[model samples]
Target: MASGAIAAGLPAHELAYRELKQRILYGEFKPGRPVTLQGIADELGVGLTPIRESVRRLIAERALEFHGNRRISLPQMTHARLEEIYTVRSKLEPELACRAAAHITKADIDHLEAIDGELDRAIAFGDVGAYLKHNFRFHRALYAPANSQVLLPIVESLWLQFGPSLRVVCGRYGTSGLSDQHKEIIKALRAANIGAVREAILRDIAQGCTFITDELFANENQP
Candidate 1:
């Protein structure tokens, strides 16, 4: 939390790492589309050595994979992978939300409501990027009260893996009919109802995961 850690003071590789992760988490890169390390270094405005080190960290995190011919990209989706993601998400996310409900404040609820408003607008306007970004913001804010060190990172790792595929799904079928459970989560949080928080999160995960699963398998041969 030192001032030195801000912006330029951070190491080049660390800066590149954060930037690259955000790009992946927000679906700026498509799954299975490999790009060169030097290309990433140029885009990130950092040296090749630093970018390669950053990418090595991300690859260890499973956010990126080495494609053939010395390139990297977001991992492609598979049915088995989707099934594992859904199982892990369904278990962790609802628990995180419910734990959050136990300590969530009015300020937290207000923050979530604000995010949901933008999310709703994104859905209405078919703004895929905004939808992905805001939806992530809303969930992260909702769970911040929990102050979780363990479960939260696991959930985020799941999102990093899941976000690109959700992007593909949102693009194929526009933002219409995406999950509306944020409203339910907000309502429950405002009411201070822990049970309702759990329920809403479960439905939200199930609804989104189900859509992704159905869409991913609709091809029967999709990887």
Candidate 2:
């Protein structure tokens, strides 16, 4: 049990948690797909104890549902779930950006621009994984300076629930026109226009929620 051997000083159980969380967050695990503890243990080369602990945490987070026979699955999105997550995201993400506008420094803005460049490259290459990865990174970085102890975790929880389905959407539709709100967000940040930043984030949230619904729940609200 060498400390930092696996990933920058994280304990074995923590590393196991991250390995599993990344698979779910980045869309490697499809929605509603069940997986086995033994299989994950084999893949990650960790013991079942850590994997089971990680699964317990995910289950507690409501990101995974546990069943008998040593299986767990990422839940599929329901319309009610979609709208609620959207409602929270639309409201809170804007507030985060607005708060961030007050605190984001020049260096932070420069770093965000660099991440946006990577985002553009991901889109151009039609790499869904990269696009999702960088997209989340850009927003996380933008919101980091808000220094929110409470709101940030809530928002990230919302993302963990929605992120995998978004991967499914991107794969089905392709990343041809994923909205360049990051560009607008950067411009607004430069102008110091908090309102513009809020609006851009709201539009980004709406567009993303719409994509998931249109693709997965087209008949969702129909009679």
Candidate 3:
């Protein structure tokens, strides 16, 4: 199945939605930065009709916010929402990782290693965009081996909504300040320890939540 409703050569509406969604997912759209339909149309080389439709869909998903002036922007993170997201992820992702551990092959581990290496390079260069992209790729790689027909779509929607805010979090805490849990995940996978893999994934999610929640609180307290 398509990763999302949008892809190249899809009908105009879907094409627009997917391209716009990908940009939002990659943090190309900064939180609270107003995005006009025409502006997105210009950026994506499409028309305003498709942009308008896609923006509406994104708003319904809570991925984009429609403001008083009719401006649309990425939603800023809140403690409650962040907590809720982490809570769901804590429950779901570890389960998926555990399943992945059972089914993972040597090639899967090697692919994960390669992705993590790229992630490290992104962090080293302070390439926040690349870091976020590769981090998504790493998780997707880890879970794909599980062949989850049921959980994949739900997990993907969650990732789509969470992606932009994650970029902001990465900015607040640079690569040096971040913990690398993919290493532990890889080790547990190699050992074929399902429990260990689950724990490792839980730790990974919690570690990221810490960074984001800390930053959110810090910003909340600012004058």
- lDDT accuracy of residue 69 in candidate 2: 97
Cα lDDT listed for each candidate: 0.87, 0.88, 0.82
Ranking under TM-score, best-scoring first?
A: 2, 1, 3
Root-mean-square deviation of Cα positions for candidate 1 versus the true structure, in angstroms:
2.9
Candidate 1: which pairs clash? Answer: none
What is the TM-score of each predicted model, taking all chains together? 0.92, 0.93, 0.87
Scored by Cα lDDT, where does model 3 land? Answer: 0.82
What are the per-model numbers of colliding residue pairs?
Answer: 0, 0, 0
Judged by whole-model lDDT over C-alpha atoms, candidate 2 comes out at 0.88
Which pairs clash in model 3?
Answer: none
Output the better candidate (2/3) by lDDT.
2
Candidate 2 structure quality by residue, lDDT tens digits, 1-223 = 3244344777777888877777788888888888899998888887889889989988877778898799988888898999999998998999999999999999999999999999899989999999999988999999999999999988887888999999998999889968758889999999999999999999889988988888889976789
| Clashes by residue pair, model 2 | none
In the range 3-119, model 3's lDDT, one tens digit per residue, is 233434477778778777788888888888886777777877777777789888888777888875557888777788888888989999998888887888999999999999999
Error of 2 at 150 (Å): 1.5
lDDT of 1 by residue, 82-171 (tens): 889989998999899988899988887888889999998999999999999999998899889999999998888889999999999898
